[model samples]
Target: MTTNLTPAKTSANTVSADEGLFKPGSKLKHKKSGGFYRVVMLANIEANLAPAYVYESLQNQNFWIRPQAEMEDGRFELVSE
Candidate 1:
């Protein structure tokens, strides 16, 4: 689980960024809101094709799906704890 408080670490999802970094059991943060979240499931529930993730946040304790591209954009980082 990781949340980057500083803007110095993001690079708009560079090619060298970790694409598979956010998977089930991974922790993340919403940079814009500074809220923490975790990836709970990666369902094959595209319903004919959609993003394949369901996440819950510690701040709100609810589940929702975010665009996979946003994770790739360096908004969610790996928490080094």
Candidate 2:
């Protein structure tokens, strides 16, 4: 039997799909901390399949992940795409 491999959608009903906002290598800045980061890619949480953004810190090169909704909730401003 064939098995479906498609990933599940996010559980957030209010948040829209992450499209045309940013792409891989896009630069962003945190509004509160003024820290800068670069977009690595869009990822999903393995446990719940929640959409998340995979990014890297420009200051220390540490990678981080945040839910897609929070990432677009005015906390992070796009610096360059």
List the global CA lDDT of all models.
Answer: 0.57, 0.75
Stretch of 10 with least lDDT, candidate 2: 1-10
lDDT tens readout by residue for model 2, 1-81: 222232335455322235527677799999999999988777677777667777889998888989888998999999898
Model 2 pairs in collision: none
Task: TM-score for candidate 1, please give it.
Answer: 0.59
What digit string (tens of lDDT, one per residue) describes model 1 on residues 1-81? 444221113343322113345766678877777888877654333344334456788786777766555565877666632
- The residue pairs that clash in candidate 1, if any, are 1-79, 2-79, 46-49
> How many clashes does the backbone of model 1 have?
3
Q: Which stretches of candidate 1 lie over 4 Å from their true place?
A: 1-19, 44-48
| Alpha carbon lDDT at 43, candidate 1 | 38
Q: Candidate 2 — which residues are off by over 4 angstroms?
A: 1-20
TM-score of model number 2: 0.75
